[model samples]
Target: MVNAFFLFILAGLAEIGGGYLVWLWLREARPLWYGILGGIILVLYGIIPTLQKFPNFGRTYAAYGGIFIFLAVIWGWGIDKKIPDTYDWIGVAVCMVGVSIMLWAPRH
Candidate 1:
């Protein structure tokens, strides 16, 4: 559903953006505030998934893992200026298919 996908995207951005800020603080020598903000956002990332309607924690997180991978690739391409090759696209495609199957497939 639209809401589920939106939540997944929101959580993914929070995780990646928070981590990127921490990376900038430690690795790129940004200010301490960067790390502080990143930590806060990371906390938000942790809580966002709990908002999902899915009752199974493992299944929700597993499906989220695939979404995370897809978002990371896009983040790298756009923010890091790293263009993805054919292999990257292929891998993302595979992960997305796996995510769809895991999240939406019928159950007994």
Candidate 2:
């Protein structure tokens, strides 16, 4: 459980870094290498922690899908300096809540 949480944190950071790289690439074609490299690094970095933490790859990936959606919105607004409108906020909130349930709900 502890490992899982730690990896999740790392995954979040990796995603944020990856998103920033993509954003940069969009602005400056010259930085395409950085974006490509950063994406590969971020994905590889994230994979180790995820596999080490979760027994099932499917579950880990499923959780990531939700987390990524939420974080992507934050990355777009916070890092990219683009303000999200009301609908965007609402969608993020809804998805995050669902993610919370998916990750935390006890199965008996």
Candidate 3:
């Protein structure tokens, strides 16, 4: 459980951080190196989930969506200087509950 969450965190950071770098290079016009590094990190983001013990690809990625959303909110708050409003917190809570159900539900 803890290991799974840790992996999720790593994946989220890689994906979001990489995307941000690409966005900076393209939209913000930072530099080409930003995009290059971002692309590499994005590749890492894709590969990180495969290291998980979970065998179900569908379930693993599905649960990761929830973690991604939660992490995105934090990333926006910290990196983008966007404070999450009440609605954002509510949505994050819903995502967390959904993730818990999807990942931790007992098999039939």
What are the lDDT scores of the predictions, listed in order?
0.97, 0.72, 0.97
Number of colliding residue pairs in each model: 0, 0, 0
How close to the true structure is residue 94 of candidate 1, measured as C-alpha lDDT?
Answer: 96
The true-structure Cα RMSD of candidate 1 reads 0.5
Which of the two, 1 or 2, has more lDDT?
1
Clashes of 2: 0
Off by over 4 Å in 2: 1-6, 46-52
Q: Give the per-residue lDDT of model 3 (tens digit) for 1-108.
A: 999999999999999999999999999989899999999999999999999999899999999999999999999999999999999999999999999999889988
TM-score of each: 0.99, 0.70, 0.98
Cα shift from native, residue 72, model 3 (Å): 0.3
Model 1 TM: 0.99
lDDT score at residue 86, model 3, on the 0-100 scale: 99
